[model samples]
Target: MINPNLALKVLDSPFHHTVIHNFLDLDQASLSLEALAEQEFIPTESDLFSYSASNNLSISDNPDIKSLYDSLCSKAWIRKLESLFDVSLSGNVDMAAYVYMNGDFLLPHDDELDSRLLAYSLHLTPNMTLSDGGSFDFFSSNTEGEAKEIVKQVVPKFNSIVIFKVTPESWHQVSEILSDVQRFSLTGWYHG
Candidate 1:
């Protein structure tokens, strides 16, 4: 469930992004995230990014993780997000668990894709800090439309969620992880 106040904050952002803390039931979400982290992760690598990602997690065997995924796609949840962002979510959500270890990073890019209306990341990292260098950095374009410096950086924190409207100017990246600890999160896109 989303708070109306938080939704308003997201709607009022420069590029329309809102960060929500305690996004889910803390105890239940934590347990599920821990279970999801134990599963096998396939290596996702490219010139633009490097990280480990799981297959579509909606079919997860872990009950808690499955529930979390289900809620994100549920009609009720869709209504909540739609009410806030003014986007018509198709009630179809694609999501997966991701792991970023030291040196893992994603370069800046707009998450432009067919059917995608919003991009989201729910941080499950238990004890990460800014010093860890794995923050979700948001960018704004310059006059000529080139990607500019990061305007906002979100340090991954347990039970926190970041929702960004996926548009041409919505460029963002995951900064390199400097710590040895693994950075964990559930990320996905909601379709229109």
Candidate 2:
């Protein structure tokens, strides 16, 4: 179940972002993790990123995956997000499961895509530490909105959801995974 008194603690140094710990109840989070393991993930690579990812969860047949997606689209959830982020949403959300093993990494880039008002990652990797790598690095941007330097690093925590406003200045990347333990997460964007 969604945490009723979820607090949106905003981070403002490099860019605007927010993280909510224990976003889901224990049972739901465990079930979601199990469902993710059951999905088919394909190795995907580009000049920007290298990771294994399943297709969009919006069309997933798995009941747990569907439930998770449905919960994000629910009016209550949307309203909560809208209130926290201070933005109007169309209730349109896109999500996919990702697994980054050792050597996988994503290059820096701003998520300024069409209609993508906010981006999020629901971390499922338990007991992950800095030594495990796959940390989310946020970069500071120049006056012209170009990525400058990484100003902060957020280590993935279990059952935590990190959301950030998608803008030209929202430059961030997933650092290389240095351990055999895979970094598992549900990541996507909420459209306006």
C-alpha TM-scores of all predictions: 0.92, 0.96
Q: List the residue pairs that clash in candidate 2.
A: none
> What does the lDDT come to for candidate 1?
0.84
- Model 1 stretches with alpha carbons more than 4 Å out: 1-8, 11-13
Residue-wise lDDT of candidate 1 within 1-192, one digit each (tens)?
333344335654348888888787767666867787678999889999999998878787777777777778878778877977889988788888899999999999888899999999999888889999899998878887657988889998988899988888888899999989898898999999
Question: CA lDDT of each candidate?
Answer: 0.84, 0.89
In angstroms, give how far residue 48 of model 2 lies from its true place. 1.4
Point to the candidate with the largest lDDT: 2
